[model samples]
Target: MKATDPSQPRERALLVQVVLGRRDRREAEDSLAELERLADSAGAATIGCITQRRDRPTPGLFVGEGKLVDIQLACREGKANVVIFDNELSAVQVNNLDLALGIKVIDRTEVILQIFARRARSAEAKVQVELAQLQYLISRIPVSRKQQRFQGGIGMRGPGESPLQLRNAPMRRRISDLKRRLDRIGKRHASVRKRRPWPLVSLVGYTNAGKSTLLNACTQAGAYVDDRLFATLDTKTRLVHVPENRKLLLTDTVGFIRHLPHGLVASFRSTLDVARESDLLLLIADAADPGIATQIDVVHETLAEIEAEAVPYMIVLNKSDAATQDQLDHLLAIHHDAVVVSARKGEGLDKLKARIVEELLAHDVHFPGENDHG
Candidate 1:
């Protein structure tokens, strides 16, 4: 088992996706397309993609033995050095696939973890990413003796121990250490929040929905903004001045995606506590994306999982400058009170700020103020 050299050429990747029973064909295609984008984000050149319509997944190979053979052939023809599946693979499936395909076998969860590992900058974020990666690895200890020989690759590297070291008690001890560190950090964050006098507002949205740009527009926080998926993994907070000399704490968090890994959600609980504890949620959505509706649903589902669904939130239809009139109308129809804005051009930000003030005032009127000891 050896580590891959960074100076070596990028791997050519072949993507595999399954359209399970009763799944919409269009949605399946869109999911596969997103997987391709994820592969690209992780520095892989996507040579080709293979999809199968199956009644259900095969227990051992996931895509069935016949489909697996086809994928192997596709990998050979495409000269692909790796195969990425759009669905999460069980330990058995991954082991069988690696043996049959004779290449690196990874899933959507691993792809996302790789991107998170690369994007994490803050210490807290790095800890969270490492914890999630380790948790995922613990569940993926290969059953086959030959599969255990697989070395570090794109999805295997993390902030801490190597994938090979994660097969035993050392990995458990590392996980415990990470948990304790994160618990300490979380308590510090909680104490800081307790001392803040201003009301809290958090930005929640799908990846590349312009939340970072909006944060820059509103408070000039100057967060690193990129056009790629999961570009902003660290949580950023800034003081935002509303009307009447009032100020509120605005926090930006990692974006949500369809089929987000459960391990990530659990590991990032502390970071997402900003959303759960916020006085108001500024739910941003990309108005220009055709899949905006589905994206919104995914965000809502994730928020619910974090117990943030009960919090007061407003839908923000961002990227208005790039959105068509029809698209805006459709979103407005779905979320009757959604605020429309273009965060990149700083369009409609004043109205957005005003709306924030209005929402805060409304919230204060309904709930007890921080100063009210009663």
Candidate 2:
């Protein structure tokens, strides 16, 4: 699909999803809601949504023919310019859908890539986003080329190469270049980490779970905080002082979400290494979000995927000021050792820091000497 024009108004999006079984109805709805948030984050206006239940997806269009007609009519009624599917669409599926609906069709992965592309600020982040985007596009090039050929656009390609080859070659080269750049940056980051004297502590949690707020409150690092999914892409590290004039390296990392793209995880492995290498991890979670338990599970699963599951860590139930007493009690019952804190209102921060000091000291974690305070 062509990139939406920034000069034009935001494209209206119609979200589509398929419920595989009766038991998956709630999960499918939640996934669709998240896709809507992703669309909003990518600057798309959601005009409507459609859901279909099927024992399994249709190989051709994903959704059945009758559902496609309903979607087409809904698109006309809502004036939707784009169709966003909750599930990952295969290249052939994307091609068929575009031919059937006569509109841009994308899946959950593309929406996430779009958000990452827009939110990437640092050079390393930009490189990582581009690499993932290139990889995703390369996977779909075959079907795209087939469609182009059917439309008689193959003859309009550059003189020496077919359309597919012309598009894929440069993207492959770009991916190689990006990898080289990222490797250099990763080496630089590793060297710096080696020279640092403080024990590293990384804050990890679901997006919009107040990890950045806690980082700012604890370290006075002034990291940007936003109440949006994947608000912080770049890792921010700061020196935080505890009791006895001891200092620790506190790092804030990009948040995890349910069903995060594997490509993104691989591409951001360098950044995520902070969590993997940390002496202690502060698993910050929102106390008020109804999906907090599931969010915690997703964070844990992501950590395990990155080989950080065995790292010593502490659970921190944040946003205590906003959570009801019953909510706090319920979470504490489940995570008995967790420290409750409100990073935004400065509630329970001292307790959290004290807990941090206790955990690090018990583990005999390293700290800079007086002369190494810088």
Backbone clashes in candidate 2 total: 0
Instruction: Give a tens-digit lDDT track for model 2, residues 1-374.
Output: 98877745488999998887664666677678888888888888899999888888999999999999999999999999999999888988999999999999999999889989999999999999998898888877645546567444645544566655665787889889998998999889988898887889999998889999999999888998986678999999998888777788899999998889888888888889889889999999999987788889999999998999999999999999999999999999999999999999988987888899899878877565644553
In candidate 2, list every pair of residues with a backbone clash: none
lDDT of 1 by residue, 217-325 (tens): 9998998898889988888999988766668889999999999999999898889988998989999999999888889999999999999999999999999999999
* lDDT of candidate 1 at residue 253, scale 0 to 100: 92
| Model 1, backbone clash pairs (residues 3+ apart or across chains), number | 0
10: Cα error in model 1, Å = 1.8
lDDT per model vs. reference = 0.88, 0.88
